[model samples]
Target chain A: MSEHLPQAVVALDVGGTAVKSLVVDRDGVLHRASTPTRASDGPEQSFAVVLQAVEAALAAVPPTHTAVGVGLAVPGTVDENRGVCVHSENLGWTDLPVRDLVAARTGLPVGFGHDVRAGGLAEWRLGAGRGAEDLAYLSVGTGIAAALVLGGRPVVAGGYVGEVGHGGTTDGDPCACGGRGCPETFASAAAIGRRYTRLTGTPVDGARGVLDRTLQGDRTAELVWAEAVDGLGVLVSDIVRVTGASRVVVGGGLVHAGDALLDPLREHVRRRLTVHRLPEIVPAVLGGTAGAWGSVLLGWRAAGRGDAATVERYAELHRARVTS
Target chain B: MSEHLPQAVVALDVGGTAVKSLVVDRDGVLHRASTPTRASDGPEQSFAVVLQAVEAALAAVPPTHTAVGVGLAVPGTVDENRGVCVHSENLGWTDLPVRDLVAARTGLPVGFGHDVRAGGLAEWRLGAGRGAEDLAYLSVGTGIAAALVLGGRPVVAGGYVGEVGHGGTTDGDPCACGGRGCPETFASAAAIGRRYTRLTGTPVDGARGVLDRTLQGDRTAELVWAEAVDGLGVLVSDIVRVTGASRVVVGGGLVHAGDALLDPLREHVRRRLTVHRLPEIVPAVLGGTAGAWGSVLLGWRAAGRGDAATVERYAELHRARVTS
Candidate 1:
């Protein structure tokens, strides 16, 4: 019966290149808008772009619906409790009072957090990480990062908790990040394409193009793919051992490869583990909408509607809508 | 005033080879006892030996002091909430109702947990992990293992967490655990001695002997030590990335190598990390006594004397008394 209640939220997911804004309710996504984030223009300009995106989302709220609140997610180090963005190398922001700026401008409550963690929160609440007590969502995008949810709470650790891409592992090549053995050098979506092109002297589309070549029985493509799987195996093993993550939700662009990416990586981590519980390695079904969707959660909390029943109601509605 | 009270607890730290028992109060260690564990004789005999050790410890409690409770820490997978030993290959125990049996036998409230985690608790409370909110204590014993403490609480995860010894990483050789890339194959104290003896056809006095040979300009010792350092660097980098461990207390036998082990491992991890916060890599000051000392904390909890004030009093009394 309460499903008939008209309530909505405005949310913005601020990334390095783009800021995705969405208007959402329990029923589903109502409206969406996108804007370029001129991050290199530095904090003030980026701040202006974020505010513009928020305005666009606020405008998309249906007239019949009550605009509950707004949520904002941005890249790099963030302190959610204090509502301050500590640092963002991409956007050139430091100690930016993201929540205060948005709250002051909109005269409404604002929820703020790190983009990847926000994405992981969405998965934990409504998608692949459902029912997992300890879950890790690894986002293998243009830049690789991971997010951890332990005991059903995001392990924020001042937003530096999941930079797996920067760890100097053992087998991978030197990374542009100035690390000699980082897994991102071989496994991240951009790195997969970069390595394949460097090895074959041929430009491919992206990690997707390389996957296509592998299906066609390209030996070099298979080798490159194998290296990526191995790198993921090593990194995932570390995550499992230290965090006891019972479910690993593989998210981001490379997850588009589907079984081709997960199957071998799962097998590799399995063979490497001697006395550890095998976590279910599954694709994050929410795709690119996760961060924005998670912002919806943040919005409801800011609106004082963040009860378990409210979240569960959305879980029943959104999971059916998005996952399907 | 609390320091004048003569109250105590009996505690046991059961390892694969030996069972250490301690009778203690806030002031410091009062009584210590050790017994060989015939773990190969299976669960019944091992259980009998444990009971005998407990009896001995109870007897050692001074006549004037009241023994409040008992704490028992054991190896392998443990469910602390259930007080059950889930599995222990060394002791051939599975589904052993440890707390029930001990409590019924002694008529005392019993506290139970994993041994390595117990040691980590000791460190977090009174040793190198003193001020760290998120800490990892790596025990480089005959078999390498680690224990985690997050948010000032031990990450139990049904005792499957912190098996870094068994993770299939990228640098180390094949281990007896059937993993081709476990850090334990190289970085463990046992592994260090084994590798040194295998290369030079000379037996050493454990890992300590290999350190001595390295000081004497033995090239094989240096090579073996370098491999160990590299392996540890890779594992530690992953730990820092995944867990955001601000303090890593290196415990067990190899920590005796002091700066010889820590200096190179610290530098290696520093080179491997690019963007993460620099964690302090320090030796576990309590050394082999940590697990038994940690058992004291568990004992106090069982006795209804576990509180922040009680723990703080212990910290003030024990750190000064033990650390010196």
Candidate 2:
């Protein structure tokens, strides 16, 4: 752990409930920080809390600094080149240039990116898809969305690529995107917990609780899980047809169900596809730190200091390891 | 023409019925030489015939000697990097190393490319899509397929990007791609003629004949034409949903129907799309010679003499025009 201190970059992952902060540098080492988002207090107040967190993290930084860049991974539609969070329903943000605001406050050259896309970048570069060129990252948390990486580059699709949540379904269920029958309405982690609790007389508070009951043969949990996995399969199939991705990385709050959810999804996708090669569906390796690590990488790349900073940190890490 | 006698690329476009050959310099100036394909005689027989035609054209080149490459454009899934014709369903080719064969035979580097994608490249570089970045080239011919160009690079999704013909439909007749209710079942030129002939009992020969009858107020022809337009509209809508491409260039055989198809398609797409921005649908400027010209340009780029070739040809073309 002491060996990881020298080669660190700042990563800030903004979520509705909490803002996760971390320092992950060249060697893939991690030092984490968390603060309440209080999204109801809005972008300005929440942004202040984020700034305070960054200050605290910066205080721990060692002296041999080359340059600093922040990766602010936010939800919703982001105009990445402009560094603006266009719209996030959960954060209630609309046309906010969060990148400029953060940079002005922190005096750090910041790297702004979409949350799901950033998580995918982390997994692809440092985790499950380390060598895979074509992969999809599906995050089934409070809300559902995906980040598709094709030929080693994330498919941005004119800022509308991975809206798997809003890939309007043939089913009849209302989605918060103001659409009827969207994939997120059934496949999301929140949906899994809510749907199971509603179907059965006995309530399960969270996905983990539902998973425990499911292992004990709860009929409601089993049904709800099936529906969620079915939705996931459908969404995955659509992406497969379009992108021809060779690998899929599954993560988020619901992934705690593990092999129970993954095994069935793998079977369904394989059954549905007739023409294309069936992609390997695997669990994402970065776990919870994916977004934060991804943010720092994005920041580094954005600043055009990638090679220089990486080499410097690599040398520092080697020196530290030798000394210790 | 006399002053620039030696400055031309032998552009050979291999199709099902005929092989269209021409000498085109960097300027759009063309000298034509065409012959029957005789594809049923098989690849070796067709190759012998084509070799004679190419030799005849080269012999006609009067002394001024600047031909650097042979540009061959064929209807097929071309492995552009390897310069191989992987498979062309219409041409009955499989694993033909066309570029190497042509280079060895002609003593010049060969630039081979897929006909439709080459046509799209021509349109994008010098025709309707000259100024646009994210555009689509929809070639609605005997078969229906589209080439997607994003950021001036064609989206070849692992060699299967433009297979738009098999795009399944909601309620339609069966298709040849082993899929029930595909877009090509009703939207293709052949389909248009078939539907018109079946409905009216008029025994119209082809798309042109059907269009002529429709113009004469034949009820069944009009209905078939309308349905074809609607099918095109559905395909266009699907492209928008998946790609978010804002500019589309339409070409191929059916497009010769002109405003009869375009006006109706424009109206249908506008009426159907409630949320997303309606893309500007327009016609391609490069007519029959798009593929050949684009292939020549590709050859010029490959040889590292593109700029010099363009300048020399521009000067020669200007001189020719002045002398004429």
Candidate 3:
């Protein structure tokens, strides 16, 4: 507990196919490692793999660093207050007491939360959404989802608040969620690739390939890309109107398309709004590391040092690290 | 300042056509009055009418009652923190310093807020949404709007959070707000009547007439009514997925149809949801007076007596009054 000791924490961001683990110091420096989640191994085996990843990160922490706690961000429905993974469709977990198990195994206090929500927190505090009190982080990746930060706190809502992907944006498109016309059915990165392939009866790498084909004036790719952008516009416009978010930070794989995605999407959303305060739509700067950084912040809060000053100091360090 | 004195507040609910004024005691017992807003008289004149209504409510307060504060709820965009009415298209007001003006005129502390938000607060605290930490009040009136109560507090995002009416639901239907395919263009009470009339080249009273005609097996009426219900279903389903509200209280004119509106809406939204929490949709119990009661609660908060116990006592009184 010496004041001179450099504070560090074990942070893990567990996704469906991969787990990212990091030893994050208070200076916002990251020592990183990763492991395949092996979700197909089933819940118990995947849980064991998660623990191994955490142990590896813990082992990497230098002896000079003081390890205070562990922070975990997992995908799917979560009850953060109760520290339970309520249900994760991809991970095959149901009502797992993840926090208690992690605490018991690591003998460290655990701060558990939803991955997207934690990512939103990181972006809100230190990335593109910084300085905005009301913001939304929309991740358009394998599947579309959003994380809402309102009044400076991430809205958990029993881990169900950010399912905008399930909202209807079309008339009859079939969705994997067993619903029709869902935004995710047409707007997600997976959807763009799948739709283009289905229309042309040709294999494509993913949304990236679809975008490249569209750039080369491929009719089917252009149509698919246009539909995805339109669906995204409808969804984001609805979100802005409902939440009064002053800004929306777009992230995930599709964002790599840069202005090709942003410029048209912004114009479409702008045209949809009539009386709402126009939100500044921008790109997320933290890229794929938002969840890990957010875990560090969560660990700091768990250790009782997550005041405004501490957060600002860490944010400055993060900025310096990224820029350098 | 006497501990033995009963505290009361003057509360006003201002709309485009009329203003409701009342003297509300700490127990939520209300002595009410009304005045025509005459907004066509222009902003200054309407503002004068508003002041006159406040004075009338203050005059109605019993001499033994201690009027410590005032609460005013008005339609359109408001900045509650700055106590300014940013704009009210119906009232023809912009950048009006409503709170300071009321405070100066009445020598009382003032709580100013958006009408829909205040109404939502009342419903969440004392009406159908009672006991739900996350709830939404959807008002399907002349023009549709909503009020969101999240985590037991009204979300006031500079008076813009609940503009779901302006969100698109169809491909192209002109809206007064300059947007196309807005929910209000299809689902609002006015829309039902106007669309029915436009389709049949016949005039109808309102949504009630449309419902009555449908019950009588009128084909055109059935078509219009069905469209309104479908539009409402889409909007509510989107809202449920985005906000994760456990319940939604349907209020305003359309709820008067009761089961006719609620039954089909419940079924439609249920069909649209997949892997998301299904919200309980119910009629708002406070009817049209929700806004007035909400203003009283705002006044209570402004007077520094808005603890949970105090709120509960007021809620009981409100329930008794409404039931009686």
Candidate 4:
């Protein structure tokens, strides 16, 4: 009788810019919160930022439900099984036992993993990659990364599996990852904004602004956009060849470019792969909430309520919230 | 008491150049044979060639042993699960049900797979990729291809998984596969031989001959050899970045170059991958026998005598043949 009505969980996606946290139950998210992540201020400050967001989300849980567990999604090389950050360039962390620390502090079970991998899991299980036995989700934000889902599960090769942004040796200039000729240097959403700004000395909103200008026939915007498309084509073509992923889900802020981005990118990949079975390149369906929703899965997993079947139930519940 | 004799299986690796076959029991290979493959003469001739090799191998089986099954390894998009060749450019075949047809003709059960994939399976199970959970086997002969083994098993992906030769968008002229900038145009052993002869108008044995001349300070040989290494470096770097394979097993004819090939190839791969985990690039231990041995595995599988444990038992038997 004292089993505490119904239980919910707190999920946090710790990105470089902000910590997006949510309180969710089997019925879907009831509340959400965001907090600044002082990532450059080091691991301690970032940890604090995460804790603040978690606490706030927990407090916002519906009065009928009690928060039971926590799901933490972070950046960098993570050992999901051990719930440890092997290395995170953004958080300045190494060998940090995030699950144990958060579990101890919150007195709740914890599930932890790489942020991109988490988002990919959500996409694979219930979004764009639902029916795919193998899928590659390419997230093209300020930086590019991929989450490989093979055999209906994410391929987490000790967090080294999907660093295609830094892995690709395609067209480009010097990159922040200490490599030259990286595809993302010329293709990422941020790259479009930066290159366009530098070349034209004209300020635009972001990749979105550049796309708008391109639609309006801005020469600099067209060049920047065209180069981005070509670089992505090389990256995706290489990815299809190497991984044999038949379905490719392109995500992140740049997906807003829609047909303007996908059409030319598809042309580039098709032109390059003459003898290969072409992969289905499509926009990611989950958008920005992927990581946060993926966090819900992690939270449910930590609470011993997650599996393929449970994922369906949550998908049903959350999908109702989304579409309705 | 009447079950007196051990059973052997006939295995055939049908390639564009030849059909190499062997007879093997639980202990190891006992006999081998090869016949020219009339591959360009069309599918029927190729099938006849394969049958001749199989018959020759079965006839060579030890007098005390009974032949039980057959294993066929072919190129192109093979549905190993269905034992059908979806397409083979070399054999000029499409949807050719090799296993079923051979089984009907020989009145025996049969197993089948892609030749390069079978070779990679052998390498992963008992050779260069012995203990690697994920490994990439790159075979460079007249052409180039890769067999990817992930999570201790080969990734079949409906046989579209590893076509890195024509997959890479790199520096090159036009390719035979109707694509521009394919890595194989420069990196394959045939490419090395063809380019050197085209440039110097001097007769050479092959890539091996070019290497010998390069060692003797032949300038044209040096240029050709350098380009091959550079092309391979780009391909391998992209492969490493995209697949996250921590070990690369290089096989086929060019591996004979030893340090001359590996050293410069390693330098190129390193120069390209600035931030990825450097893979252990090594030579394949099996040399040319990998496909035949892998066919032995398929034969055993068809005979209901294969599994992870059976793979171990066969490895033990074959290792004796290899070493002693």
Candidate 5:
């Protein structure tokens, strides 16, 4: 271990269930750690967990890897310009100066952003959307939303843009967002599982179980899955028409289903389009680590060291890590 | 015209039936003219008409005004970068090098763009959307489309963006774009008129007739209008959610109905929105002349003379002319 090595950064993706932390150097990831968020304990305890997670990541940094900055990707409505977490329905955070608090504890500059946006940034810069000037990253996890990247820059419209989840898709089921027929109500991972259970009076693990049941020729499961796919198609078609994004990278738990999800979706959207050019729908290559990698990129950007070549290097390293 | 005077520009708004041209100077519109497009005569004849319209506008420049550039706004799928009118179902233009031809004819630089985008630029820079970084210009004319301006720059995704008209809305009647349930099938001025006619076996002039019938207590007209308003509301609500646009400027023939169109439409969209901030919905002030004024602005921008102050000067002069 030598101090002469190029500086690295600490990255954290804070979720309600767990915090994924990483020490990312120019060569590759130097260390990784995952810790419980303990979000239900209260906002104070959750903040403490965030701080501890960062500390542990920093402690894992090799002597040869000097930490330059820290990046945190949290799930919620965040005001990135002000370094404040405006609100998080999941983590129960409100107006928390997480960036300032983290910076004070670590004595390093902190780049704070929304989790979905961070993941989108990573995908746009390093994964499926690489080289695309206009792209969208649609994450269909517990909830459905999108990260819009236009003109080679991620659109952060006061952190309020990319709420496609709540955009109405039908006039049937009411959404948790207090709207009927929202894309989230039909296509979200949580929604798919809930709908399947509600329709058949049986419990399921998640979207994966529903997808599996559909593949096994369960009529109820097939109907629920088809509904989810149709809803997603409508949402994607709207995004493509509105944004003219050439590429749409699908991520989150639903993407793991691979062609089972993409083939039908591509056909559905293609049929729906009339004047708009058909966008290339693809899977996110970064998997669960995308948010953490996005945090690393954000940290580098915050440190003013995020050149295109540097980003390429990190992306190549991450790809190699996943393959190996 | 004296060469020493401040340079002005020739602007034209080319539509299916007519072309509106203007000689715009520092003091505002120095001269205005209108002529038939003769678009039924085929693409070559229509192109000749465009040239004649430019010549007519250039000829109207006052002795103190020196014409420096020309700008043309045309309906259809325009490739602004390549200066080609990709396709225009209305004007019958396909892959026409409008910019190059106009430039060659006028022996001056030309600025060419989509008609809706030109109107949107005018609204964003000089009309209702002034001072807002994120806004949408929704034109509910023969067809419904939007021009999205984000972060003070119009989102021109290869001229394919803002095709909200073709995005499905209800899965009912087939749209002219070969899609069913598209916004254009339910919300466009043409759709409103056609739906009203089909519902009551009465041929009406246009959307105005439908609105008039609705005000006269016709249940059929009221239902048609209500459906159009609802479709438009869903479209606008989706736009607001996806783009976080702070203001939505409604233009085109439909806006002439004023509060008749705005009041209920606003309420419908407001009710649909859940978490997103409600954007102020207002009518476009520039009216039919917006496209010509926008062409003028584009010409100035192309001539490397466009700045905020220059735009403000032109806008002030235009406002004075309207007031007078």
Candidate 6:
């Protein structure tokens, strides 16, 4: 609907561990630059460091780039439409004017979005969920979160769709969200490690060590793994009942366990949901780069370059970048 | 719009114990007729009886109708678009070709819909949910069922909604649906009477006797009542979680217990949901007549009569019926 503007946008994906930045042109080509998050320094200092990374990424861009716009994907709840980080417990943030702050520092238009939901959008459009209309992407990293895409539009569900953290667990497990019984308290990668440590008084690195111990015939590790699977089953059952998703893409840090996690979680859900059709649970194809790719996609859409007509423009730009 | 048609559509609402027939003119004036369902006689005998009732209601019309279209509402799971009764445990139906059978018999276009969902549509458009866009209506009669109206469209949720009967209870309870613990196994009006009969070793007529006994400080009755309230609370909490509804309209036989049932159930849901916004739980405005009124509204919409635009047409039709 508007004239095509050949511009490169700055994309930032802020996770608990690191901040990933990319200078992406109208094409989906990424000139990547990443740095340690250092979230302990709080929002002010970390934001300054993020600005430096963004500036460095933008400075690398060619002279053809004009009017820099930034797309940010941040972990935790976001008032996305307003470009504010409402509350990101992992980042020690409360009502931070992130987009405004970034804009003030970089003097660029910013688009803000929830990290998992933005990743889900990328998965739905170009990754695992490509050509699929109705889908739910469950990213099970430090915590379990979901993004439901229906009719190509995500059902905000009053912003409760991905708050799977507060969904009740079988037993009363403590959650940081103040809920005594939540799926996240039992099934998250953090929960797996916590449970294993609590059971055997052996502090493991994360879910990977817990799984390793279980496979090595550690009885306590086996019990913790079983409970984690059961917690996941409840979440999967509830999602199937409410969202009617035909396909679910599962991703995140915990998925590193791979078939060990997938096999049992799938079996448990199949056993519980006897009445309805079960959706296929598959690993995410986009992997670690999903959020950054999603941020770039968001920027492309924001720049009015997301539609049937623009696919050719995208292809041409992508080809030119590859040839160059 | 096209020129106003003088034709009247026949609306049949078939419940477990009753069959209600209405000759609703284009404006939705119901000339009502009814009879016992006699469902134990089986679908064949009962369907024949329904046809006769429809014919009689048609004969009672002041003016012989033009091209007739019939809208029939039935209890249980249905393929609404296909006009097939996929299954009705109450009606002893399985994969019944209801639309084709009725259409063949009546020689008219037939529209079939799930009774609860159709009733919810009626309520959302012309009853309790008249102005509200997003609403969830729970009907608790012989069983407990729910209907979600979102943006004026009743969500079927893969045809699993309105099956609140299967929602498991907090405490284990016997349910006829072959589940160990189900909401309807304790909270339904049928459950109240059954619980009373089991406790006293005497046949209590219905929910009213149990309510009366509870008022009289009968320990058995009080326990039963509390369990029912708790069961209902779990169902409502799950509904609130999935739909994010801020207002719930409850109807059916159990709701007649009034504040005794409503107050406690509301309090339980409020206490359970700490994180999500609590919805207002209120009695349905449609009362016992919701089904019949909803049938009329369904016929009205099916006949291309708009609620806001058909005030004069509705008045004229009402006057015509009154004089005739």
**Strongest candidate by DockQ:** 3
TM-score of chain B of 6: 0.87
Cα-based lDDT at residue A94, candidate 1: 89
Q: Could you tell me the lDDT of residue B148 within candidate 2?
A: 71
lDDT of 4 by residue, A1-324 (tens): 426678898899999888998888776678888888999888888888887887788789878887778998998888787889988888888899999998988899998988888888888776777789778999999888888876555776656777888844544588888887676777889888988999999988989999999989999899999988988888888888877788899998898888988999888898878778799999887888888878888988898878677678766765666578
lDDT tens digits, residues A1-324, model 2? 444334456778888888888776666455678888888987677767777877766664555543366777988777677788777766888888888987888787888888888988877776666667668898888877788675556765555546667633333676665555666677888877777777776677777777777789988787778888887886665556445567889988778778988999888776545434478898886677778767877777766656755745544553464357
Clash totals, every prediction: 0, 0, 0, 0, 0, 0
DockQ-derived CAPRI band for the predicted complex in model 1: medium
Segments of candidate 1 deviating more than 4 angstroms: A1-7, A170-174, B1-7, B169-174
lDDT of 6 by residue, B77-149 (tens): 7766667787887677888888788778877667677888777766676556666545778888888888876
Clashing pairs in 5: none
**Chain A TM per prediction:** 0.94, 0.88, 0.95, 0.93, 0.95, 0.87
Better of 3 and 4 by DockQ: 3
Name the candidate, 2 or 5, with the larger DockQ value. Answer: 5
Question: What TM-score does each of the candidates earn?
Answer: 0.94, 0.80, 0.97, 0.93, 0.95, 0.81
* Residue ranges of candidate 4 with Cα displaced over 4 Å: A1-7, A55-63, A66-69, A104-109, A167-172, A302-304, A314-324, B1-4, B66-69, B103-109, B170-172, B307-310, B313-324
- lDDT for each residue of candidate 1 in A1-324, tens digit (9 for 90 to 100): 434659888988899999999898767779988889999888899999999888888888887786779998988878777899988888999888889989999988998988888989888988889888889999999878888887667787656688898866544577776776677788899998999999999999989999999999999999999988888887787799888888999999999999999999899888767788888999998889888878888888888877787678867876677657
Report lDDT per candidate: 0.85, 0.71, 0.86, 0.83, 0.87, 0.72
Q: Could you tell me the lDDT of residue B278 within candidate 1? A: 74
DockQ of 2: 0.20
Residue B212 C-alpha lDDT in model 2: 92
Q: On a 0 to 100 scale, what is the lDDT of residue B5 in model 2? A: 54
- On the 0 to 100 scale, the lDDT of residue A50 in model 2 is 73
User: What would the TM-score be for candidate 5 when compared with the true structure?
Assistant: 0.95
Give the residue spans of candidate 5 off by over 4 A. Answer: A1-5, A318-324, B1-3, B318-324
What lDDT tens digits, residue by residue, belong to model 1 across residues B126-203?
788998877889888887788887666677766678888886654457787677667777788999999888888898
Please give the distance, in angstroms, between residue A154's alpha carbon in candidate 3 and its true position after superposition. Answer: 1.5
